[model samples]
Target: MASSRLYLSAKSAAALDAELMSSGGFSLDQLMELAGLSCAQAVYKSHPPESKRNVLIIAGPGNNGGDGLVAARHLKLFGYDPVVYYPKRPNKDIYNRLFTQLSNLKVSFTDDVNKAITETDQILDAIFGFSFQPPIRDPFVQVIRLLESTEKPVISVDIPSSWNVDSGPPKSGELGAAFMPDVLVSLTAPKPAAKFFKGRHFLGGRFVSKEIAKKWGFSLPDYPGVDQIVELPADNEKL
Candidate 1:
């Protein structure tokens, strides 16, 4: 695996996505599919189906949520009983298609956020990505509060919800409950906020093109053998 010192800001990562598309090596659909698949793999590796098969995925209203929805489908195939709590569905047709896919896979959706946690052995925090801002609204806030209250571990996808793109979090330091997670699965590379993640950190999304990687000076470690995920060095060890 590559050394853990490399970090990419939100904007840069997005640019890499665009560049890859331009190169004709990847499309948004293909990228999302692989990204979500990688998340499922990480979840499986961290907590196998036999250990904690009940996964409660809290999907947001954007691409991050789509990733979660996709991950849910894969997790079910991987033998884990997966459920989703998607309170806000995007108006975009793409999300609608994803919703349909998950439904077709027989992955159930729950309306009661708090009750959902009680029914899960682990939580997948896919409510936000690198672009999410603070002052989270309504039912989501309540849901976050409930996750904090529970003792079960949460596996956050990409950047943790409500955190800034470049910085770890706000200086006011009020987002106590939702700021941390048990495991963080970063797609492509780690963002700045990932530096504060005090848990198992794994890097996914090894599908980046060499052309884009060179342009951005992004050095990626080869995926060890055929594995899709690689564990990152801890925060302190990053130096």
Candidate 2:
């Protein structure tokens, strides 16, 4: 993970997350890949694809759902047949475009989250983005409960579902009341909530950063010290 502290308050992070969706960073579909790839790297680190393990992705209705769909598509590209489960029908136009892309890739989508959970080796929680609205009920709550029961390792994109990224975790105070994701994949910068409230469970990495060449391990084309234009050897010297 590229380590550089780009600070932003939870509120700011949420705002940026929202703004980036609107800005042409690369359309909503591309932002989905940005968010999804961040989580996918964590999954790859934990469970390498060569092992042939199953990954279950829980998608919500909004852009969060788009992130999971993006991840599922990438996982398929990486040779992992991830099962994607979204409880509600996707309502966003971006999500619809993503659904079409996933269909083109032949990735499976289902509403049967229970079955998806039952069979996967790893679970990815992509249900909620940074924004949190209250009155957590039915399908989402039930899905959270099922995930709690499962012993599989879980990765969450942005914040886990049923938890407010701003105010903190859920307050139902049940046995597994508050949301806890094993790995929390953050984009661009770390959210304040993930730093202060989330404690040791938080793990963040950026999607893309401004740069070129070899400042760090990553190499970029035409980067300052790297791939600098130089004169070719003279014909006599070549001999």
Quick one: best lDDT, which candidate? 1
Residue 124 CA displacement from its true place in model 1, Å = 0.5
lDDT (Cα, tens digit) per residue for candidate 1, span 79-127 = 9999999999878877888888888889999998888898899999899
Q: What is the C-alpha lDDT of each candidate?
A: 0.81, 0.63
What's the number of clashes in each of the models? 0, 0
Q: Could you give the C-alpha RMSD of every candidate to the true structure, in order shown?
A: 2.4, 10.9
**Model 2 worst lDDT window (10 residues):** 227-236
Q: What is the TM-score of each candidate against the true structure?
A: 0.91, 0.74
What's the lDDT for residue 229 in model 2?
17
